[model samples]
Target: MRTRTEENPDYCAIESAMEVLGGRWKLAILKQLTPGTLRFGELGRALPAITPRMLTRQLRELETDGLVTRTVYREVPPRVEYTLTDAAHRLDAIMSQLDTWGRWYRDTVRPGDAERVT
Candidate 1:
């Protein structure tokens, strides 16, 4: 249920970003992986709502995009872990900005006349 959108060549940057992180689950995936390497089961437990199949698919895409590194260990039970690569650290600054914007939105834009947390 996806469609290509190169129709507006001028929006290459927007499209490119979307191509990388465009999905309901991608950001949550990145956030969970940001802390450190984790086993598949650990990731699954941390993100209770995400199905194992979907997490596997996202991990594969992130590995292909050079954002995540996957390692497998040879053992009886078998072990697999995923860690964020240096390239993904670039998101730190962007995430900080997003945090600021979120605070601003909650303080100024959100309605219902709720009291500010600050």
Candidate 2:
């Protein structure tokens, strides 16, 4: 994966941030991680659309971003859990704001408003 700086010399902070968490499953993974740590199987069940290989790939990206931590236990069969790092917890506040804004938009906007667009 290319570093954002290498990808864009004049990149703004929000663009850099989006590069980290803007994938199809990234934000959904973050939402699931907020409740607590979860095993690979649990995450798989929570997001039925994602395959095992894809989940592993996305988790690795999140780990690389410093937004998530993966722990392994040396049990009979290796037990592992994924949890959000401190950096990711900061997203909670932002997500909450987005939720509020979404509700407001849904309440105030009509579906036919798109007719005005040309």
Candidate 3:
């Protein structure tokens, strides 16, 4: 994969979006946060397949990309929460459409495969 910089660019918009939204877990994390803010533990439970380290890395990337905002409250033990930025909310419709298309493909194109994967 090529690294993108502000000074030089040569990728399409979709590629740029994928750069931030790439990987299996980013989208799932975003979907979990779509309803509202969630704690680290909650997110971990929601995405049981993701390791804690990988989840932290993805959250950091999302924060760097301006897709997510991480808020840490000053407390005794320490509390941190994540919420979507305006940019991520903008993807709601697109993600919904993709979900619909994915279901259609799984149901019609590969009926047997979906059950095995899930």
The predictions' CA RMSDs to the true structure, in order, are: 3.9, 3.5, 4.2
Q: After superposition, how far is residue 37 of candidate 3 from its true place, in Å?
A: 0.6
Looking at candidate 2, the ten consecutive residues that score lowest on lDDT are: 2-11
What TM-score should be assigned to candidate 3?
Answer: 0.83
TM-score of 2: 0.79
Greater TM-score among 1 and 3 belongs to 3
Model 2 stretches astray by more than 4 angstroms: 5-11, 99-118
State the local distance difference test value for candidate 1: 0.79
Tens-place lDDT digits, model 1, residues 34-78: 879999999999999999999999888778777889999999799
Ranking by TM-score: 3, 2, 1
Superposed on all Cα atoms, model 2 deviates from the true structure by an RMSD in Å of 3.5
TM-score for each model: 0.74, 0.79, 0.83
lDDT of 3 by residue, 1-118 (tens): 4356343456556667777888989988998999999999999999999999999999999999899999999998899999999999998998888889888776677655655553
Candidate 1 residue spans exceeding 4 A from truth:
1-11, 99-118
- Minimum summed lDDT over a 10-residue window in model 3 is located at 1-10
